[model samples]
Target: MNKLWGFIVAYFLRWFPHGLEPGLRRIGNPGPESPVLVSGNFSLTLKRLIRSLVGQDLWLLVANSRGINVWCAAVGGMFTHHNVIAAIKTSGLADQVRHREVILPQLCAAGMDVKAIREEAGFQVRFGPVRAEDLPAYLAQGKKKTDAMSRFRFDLRHRLDMLLSNNTMFYLIVAIPLAIFWPHRLLAFTLLFWAAAFYLYLLFPYLPGKTGWSRSLYSALAVVLAIPAADFFRAGQPFLHYGWMIAVVLVFSTVGFDAAGILAAMPSDAEAFLHRLGIKRLGSLLQEKTLGRVALDREKCRGDMICYSICPVGVFGELDPDKKITLPWQNACFACGACVKQCPHDALSLQPRP
Candidate 1:
């Protein structure tokens, strides 16, 4: 009965026309002696991780992370000491767990200060495997992660889930039109979904292009060109009539391109390429940090918090009564140039890091 309800909920969530966000789960509880595992409350991560640990007798200490996954939330600074401490205190985790330790994903180290967490809260943070699947093995083997467990891999199965599950809205809406008008369209759509899914998932690393976008555009163009040729030979018709097929090919192919951002693995190949390009440009611009620092001269800052508001990284802090604001934690800047754009007086300059 419980499994049935869970399936229903998952399906309803997939079909529902709403944006995905993380939230806390009020789930079944385990005894104090049961090991407590910590994770972000991102709905997708929590649901899948909990599903993976279905048979285990454990307590999940889901920290409120504003719906971000563990690694992302940590790096983005939303899943911080305040959130962890607040979760522990507010969730009454002390009363539910016998041990003074909680297992957290290793990737979370970037955002979280483990030492601070320990000092503020008595609970010692235990680093687990990078992926949640290693939890059972690590837990069984007395809390040690094997090197194999820590390494990240974007296998075919992971890609399929991300591509299909993340943009389920696209599928569902497309399906309705096909079902009503193009009754024979369902099979073609399915094949297109899985084929592009497999290609993006399995062949993305080897795809013959620089960026995922470039790869996608070229691949799409090739298919678009070939479809008319195929149609010409099949129906003995001109390419003009089959222009719709080219549109179809382009649409599906570019969907995979867009999926690269959200579906691909961390430090995603697509993102990595962009990062590499950005790093090169920044390195050239800074000239070894010899220029002025990229900072707010408080005298020039109007307490408008434009830098704080426009930063994609959530790096800037609110202005205090003393007209002071803070930058990201040391060395945490991604150098996206958003702050520089937001500065009205050109006060925020990209100075070399000292």
Candidate 2:
């Protein structure tokens, strides 16, 4: 029953950032020589990490990230060098561990500065595998990450997981107002919204568009067309039929805009695309472009390949032994700042695009 309740809440009320207490936690009765791993204070993430490390003897340092997952918190600037240092200092981890190394989740590389952490807290940060499930194998392999473990894949499972986790909050917030104000159309709207969501997620890769916004908009249009087609088949009054159709289109289009924000690799561009669609009344969908082009200072680069392994998107090219890091496709950069933050020599920076 507890598990059932957690599942429902995770799917429905996940927007609320439920966080755990920030401190050092001993997993499986670890001693001073045990490996130390650090993560954000998101409740679900903590639970998953605990489950993954059930039999392992290690130290877990939980940093305050306002209850957001590592990747989102890192990208949103909630998880950073300061948070890591705070966790280390507050937890008294320096006195507990003999080794100076701490394992951080690979996703946190976007915002976490290894140099800053080493300077402030006296700990060397080593990035772990992308997923917690791979931690056992990662440890067994002497903490060596395979290429597949480092790379981020947005496959069907990942897309569906993201869809369910994100839509849970959307449903709770939108469902109440919809039932209270437009009770007559509540069921229709709810069903249409979910149907459009599934279509967009399931057909994400094959959807006809260059950008996430375009693909979601196309999917929303496909679902919205059914309303008019149904009206035509029933030979309903034109005024009533078109009015209902307009309402449905407006609601679905708004949802499409929301989906664009969640599913798009570059959310700022998605917002711009929605603006082009004449959507001006979006309450929270307006994300301004704060990060510009990711720049590499070749003279400072040491060719460490840390950025190459950490980037979720293939933004950085393969590192040649003789050449510095090259930006072959800067347009594909998501501006997560992982490469910039993890660069050992501080060779990478984000410059405002001209």
Error of 1 at 316 (Å): 29
Best-performing candidate as measured by TM-score: 2
Model 2 Cα lDDT, one tens digit per residue, 1-354? 966765565554555566778999999989998999999988787898899998999999999987778887777677898999999998899899898999999988888878889999999989999989889899989999987888677678777876767665666577789798989867876886687677776777777877666776666567567767777677863344666566556655555554544554543554455446765433222423335668888889888787888876667887666678777777666677788877878898888666
Model 2 TM-score is: 0.85
lDDT values for all models: 0.59, 0.75
lDDT of 1: 0.59
What value does the lDDT take at residue 310 in candidate 1? 43
The C-alpha RMSD in Å for every predicted model, in order, reads 12.0, 3.8
* Cα-based TM-score, every candidate: 0.60, 0.85
> What is the total number of backbone clashes in candidate 2?
0
The regions of model 1 sitting more than 4 angstroms off are: 1-34, 51-58, 75-78, 95-99, 173-194, 231-238, 262-354
